[model samples]
Target: MIFDKLKKFDIVFDSPEMDCPPVFSSGDVVSGKVVLELSAESKVESLKLHAEGFAKVHWTESRSAGSSTAYTQNYSDEVEYLNRREVLLQADNGELTVLSAGRHEYPFSFQLPEETLVTSFEGKHGSIRYWVKVKLHRPWATVKKIKKEFTVIEPIDINTPSLLAPQAGTKEKMARTWYRSCGQVSITAKIDRKGYTPGEVIPVFAEFDNSTSRSVVPKAYITQTQTFIARGTMKQKRAVVATLCGDIVGGNRRETWHGRAIKIPPVGPSILQCRIIKVEYMLRVCVDVPGTSKLSLEFPLVMGTIPLHPFGSRTSSVSSQYSVNIEWLRMAIPEQPEPPPDYSSVVSEEEAVQNSTEVQPEEDLSGVLQRSLMAYVQEFRLRPPPVYSEVDPNPQPFAMRPRCMTC
Candidate 1:
């Protein structure tokens, strides 16, 4: 058979059940086998298997001065974890004398660390990655190698009291032109607390006062800020993760927003511990006029691993209304299931599918090796926009006087 006359190199994971895009957590054991098949006898020096995890960030900036433009590149790489070279076959040890060749399987295993590893994240300018590699060494020919990547996620818990306390921010701005004063605008925004887990709703409260001659529009949004540091210089990228907008406010009128909710996503648990990268969240409220500068307020937020208590038990009726559009909110939150247990703990009747050559019928095996790589490439190319809820048409107007006496 043609298959019996060809050489093959493959890496197969030892899992009870075959999983597409296999997942692993911290403190887990990753075991697999490397298979080598050859129909003809060949010279061999050594065979080695390697596994590693790393994070890398890169970006470029361009600045124009007159008719000339300058471009600067920034990058950083961190090897979060690594396991190197477990020799499977060595000619120096005289284990193999290179007689007949058919199929050979070598088992390999690695125990991941229990701490300081974050979930795998792939962004436009940065990525956290893990991979396994196999190398075949020959005396006179170039070395051949195969590599495969996997996913790792670290659980985040948000049950801390500090993150649950109520948080608020206020900002007031006076608009003034060259010769005339355009009056003033004030904004105050608050959230139920600072700490939030993925898939949980966040209630927001805001009061806007438009004392200026021109009408002002009110907007609120959640922002995620990612910072990358390289060569002692820092670069930051910001994305609006969720937003809600209120109706326009007439001059001399005040508008109050209540029961507005924004849902957090599974993409975060914060990236503060990472040395080269950092992730932060914020809530911002802004009031915009036709030509004058806008007034804005900002409140810091924390993404955690635990969900808040029930609204009825821990919050008032206003908070209860936060779930007014529960169905819509559900669509925004991504599903985050718990990581599968170690392969040893699970019971299965069938043999490991990854070890079976029948699983891959295609002539080229590169597709199986590059599955994770392709997924990341697609993710970076087709990043999805943030989800948003419709603005409430009838926001209640506050009757109290403007908090800023000058306005």
Candidate 2:
């Protein structure tokens, strides 16, 4: 009977362009309409609209006591960026309003706060979201709610002098096992700039020198780290957004990457403004040696909303549609925690060697569908043998196959 009486109820957002999504930033005005359709006359109590934006992080960990007892602890935190409410329809002088309409529309508008806001983000254990909810209360019926979400993109300009600066780092790791010194491997790498946007290419130039007795494989990854802080403790989840690998270098051989490009996929802008949740990006160039820890070079990266100009001018470049859709951007992250090696802390003690294999990048990367399919292929790999491949004395660069190791 309720379904028969209520024909339709929906909330729709207005966009500047017909096909584009409604994307806003700090201090922006968001306007939308609520539609209702009724087949017969109905009595209404009150209608309210609420808009809110905040970052939330929650996860649970299990621990054991001295014996068989078990206990669970929760790590959670919240940081509010916005809270606004407005009344659309209400009772007049404590009297219920009776409506005899076939179709009704209620328009609402809310201006975001002037303070800076973090970009919209979704992660495994945490998320930063903005949404508007409508609540309808009736005399004898339970309250009904309708919610719609939006995307907020705070601009990060890569044209600034700070972001335009080049980043370079060099790190070396000794290859040793059980008090035996096989040798050492060191990497020197640099990126053209520290800031990049979606669809842009990062030119990686690096040199890997291996003096070990066994062969080594060189690789690069664009990693995204999601950090959640609560009660003075922090938890981090990583996802490999993009990957590129080089050829295998034989023992006592050298390897180099001359502007090997790693394209940035469509993802949310870096969320450095949020306190409870932080989204960071890093470019890692690593060496996978045998029977020892690998050497790596890391550089901080800023994913921005603005793209670099073709002629290096101040002219603005437009962002594509994929960047604004929060849902699509969430899909950019892998479902599983398919991250690369934790090069953050290399094997200082030469713990255990990790084996890796090669994965072929798709030939046609023209559309999102193909890129998503490529993502699945690159993340899953078979366990490698003692070495990735036989000692190719040549140690030539492998251009087509860019892989992410499963180990």
Candidate 3:
């Protein structure tokens, strides 16, 4: 009689309670063994093993403010965390055939590349840990994983600062890791005069600045409208309006417009006649870097004022000044006209001239000459009547009569 008895085994990690290295410093070799209990007299096909681990770091940047009132004080803080490091172990497996097994054991080992590891264990430590694990696999048997944790002790460093006192200007540069790039841009508007006079041009100018360490290209634009003001339903006032819009590329740049100066129309002091600065709209500016994962940042993209100037204020005065965060602005594609159709049919010289004549009306030089001649003939035919002269028919022989009287 032949008996086809199946082989059974139990897999266990050597150190189930012990933790792996807290931080896999560069060139650290992680080791573990698989403990197997073969059932009484059985045959096994094969055994497999796998080991994996990784190192990672994450942090955030934020803004904070504090205010003190007569009764109480308050402080506010905002935090933005972004992952900085990631190194994953490649999956590796080893297989072995078992001819006849009563009991067997397998060991596994692996190494983490030193160059890829970020050794930030000393300066900013509070409980940042990277984990590693060893896994054992057997043919037709359950797989077992062994997880270990360890403390990452920093090598003594005189320059290292305590966790509570992080040194200034400290930064980490890691490739393939996510980074939060920040930049500050300002939007300013200025009028030629403190106030604007009705019916006069008010010069306007704007400037943008990138204050953050990260370089950024910003969008900028400008707009202006008329606004009106009235006092107690009595007198009305008019003011010139202006605004800046569009993306401002290269943080340090200025857009100047001599046309911001607008002439106020002459009108009586009435609410209906009063004109006020109106709608001022602009697109939000933002840093557009391709390939890099875009981290979301909360910042103002637009800032400006309407009726920028108060009514009944001095003439030739500034209307309003506004600044917005680039993030808040929306992106838009400028409207573009479609291109003309390509010429598929070739035309001969004669056809080209014919088409040109057909496209343009022929001048009627002969008709113009005829009209002019007709006008001239009409003038001559309708000339004013010649003045009639009364002739002195009795211009008699006054000399003969005078001579006779003298005799």
The model with the greatest TM-score is 2
Model 2 agreement with the true structure over 60-158: per-residue lDDT tens digits? 888899888999999898999889999898876977877775998899998999989888766656778899999877777878789988877787777
Superposition TM-score, candidate 2 onto the true structure:
0.77
RMSD of 1: 15.0
lDDT of 1: 0.59
The best-first sequence of candidates by lDDT reads 2, 1, 3
Candidates' TM-scores?
0.68, 0.77, 0.22
| Ten contiguous residues minimizing lDDT sum, candidate 3 | 372-381
lDDT of 3 by residue, 211-250 (tens): 4444434222211111211221111111111212234344
Candidate 1 or 2, higher lDDT? 2
Against the unseen true structure, what C-alpha lDDT does each candidate score? 0.59, 0.68, 0.26
Clashes of 1: 5
Q: Over 4 Å off in model 3, which ranges?
A: 1-24, 42-46, 55-96, 99-103, 116-156, 159-407
Off-target runs (Cα >4 Å) in candidate 1 are: 1-7, 14-17, 40-44, 59-80, 95-103, 138-140, 177-179, 265-269, 289-292, 305-407
